[model samples]
Target: MVALYGALFLSAFLAATILPVSSEVVLAGLIVAGRGDPGLLLMVATVGNTLGSVVNWVLGRGIDSLRNRRWFPVTPDRYEQASRIFRRFGEWTLLFAWLPVVGDAFTIAAGAARVNLGVFVALVAIGKAARYAVIVAGGLWAMA
Candidate 1:
């Protein structure tokens, strides 16, 4: 049981990063199998995923130093434009951090924009928890 939960947590964590992990599948499978309490699974997944986004945020915070290097993904002008856009409309986007691909981008943008950490965590957790809650409900309904 512990191992199952641990796997779920790890999957959720990696899923939030640039890596192509899919925590939703793991979560849905666990719920369907009745391997653990649904609520606990939801909590573990949410926390793990949120922490993973935090890792992206941390990386973004330091990305500015590398923007001038040839290896940097975004041009300085583009990064500045993104930062400006994020400063204007980015915080609210954190609420959708549970999304894939773009969700990871949003988190990193939020970090680079220097959004308040507390605000970032609250919004990200809410979005992630709500997503998991829906999954949990769907799994329960399917079982019923």
Candidate 2:
């Protein structure tokens, strides 16, 4: 059970990062395997994913310092565009942080724009939790 939880957590975290991992597959596999309580799985996955987004948020906060560094891949125009989109959409875009490709960008943009940390976390948790809940429900249903 501990191993299963750890795997789920790791998968969730990686999925939330720039890496193209799919935590949903790990989650559904666990459900199919009947490894742990569904609620626990949901909680673990959500928290791990949310924390991963926070990493991007922190990176965004430091984007200015990192911009000129060769290690930083985002171009000036690209970063500016992301910041602009966040500015236009506002904090609500954090709810879509669970999405792929673009989701990580939104979280990073929120950080670069210096969004209220409290609101950023709240919205991100809500969105990520909701996504895990849906995945759990769908997995259980499909099993039945």
Candidate 3:
């Protein structure tokens, strides 16, 4: 049981990063397998995923200094485009941080834009929790 929860957490965490992990698949499988409490699984996944976004935020904070380096992952034009969109949409975009590739970019942009941490966490958590809740409900419904 503990191992299942841990794996879910790790999967959720990695899924939020640049890595190609898919936490949703792990979560759906666990729910279908009846391996853990659905609510607890949802909570674990949400927290893990939110913390993973935080990692991206932290990286964004330091990205400016390294942006000029040739080895930097994001090109200036791409970074600028993301920044422009973020600025246009404002911090409210953090609520969509659960989105796949785009979500990671949003978190990073929030950090670069110096969004308030409290706002970031609150919005991100709400979005992630809501997503997990839907997944949990769907999995339960399928079982029914």
Candidate 4:
């Protein structure tokens, strides 16, 4: 339903942020409950998750503004180190942006590293879409 997609979108968005939400749970619940078409659910989840990663990328771009804040989660040295790693490892690492824990960090680092925006969006979308595809396929397979 419309409300389900909205919840999935919000959950996916927050999951990609510093917050600890589980869009996956919402995704799986929808899948198992047979609420929406599988393809539609996959697309919605992918877009929502990708957009969340984009927020992290934008936040990465503003790291300097936040570095001095007492509430900043990352220390200055860690930021520098992550930047260095992203620089050395290359933007291909953006393919892992769908991962938990460090996935958001990768997006943030990509922003801090000033990765080409087109490349960032393309790679992030690919990774996130693939993840949703796998989840959808897995859930369907399990039910079958």
Winning model by TM-score: 3
* RMSD (CA, Å), each prediction: 3.1, 2.0, 2.1, 1.9
94-127 per-residue lDDT for model 2 (tens digits): 8988876567778888888888888988999999
TM-scores of all predicted structures: 0.86, 0.89, 0.90, 0.89
> Each candidate's lDDT (Cα)?
0.83, 0.85, 0.85, 0.82
Q: Worst 10-residue stretch by lDDT in candidate 3?
A: 70-79
| Residue runs of model 3 more than 4 Å from their true location after superposition | 67-78
Error of 3 at 73 (Å): 6.8
Candidate 4 clashes between residue pairs 3 or more apart in a chain or in different chains: none
Index of the highest-lDDT prediction: 3
Model 3 scores a TM of 0.90
Tens digits of per-residue lDDT for model 3 on 28-107?
Answer: 99888888999899999999999998887887888878567775445567667677879999998888888765687788
* Model 2 poorest ten-residue lDDT run: 70-79
Clashing pairs in 3: none
**What is the clash count of model 2?**
0
The per-residue C-alpha lDDT of model 1 at residue 144 equals 85
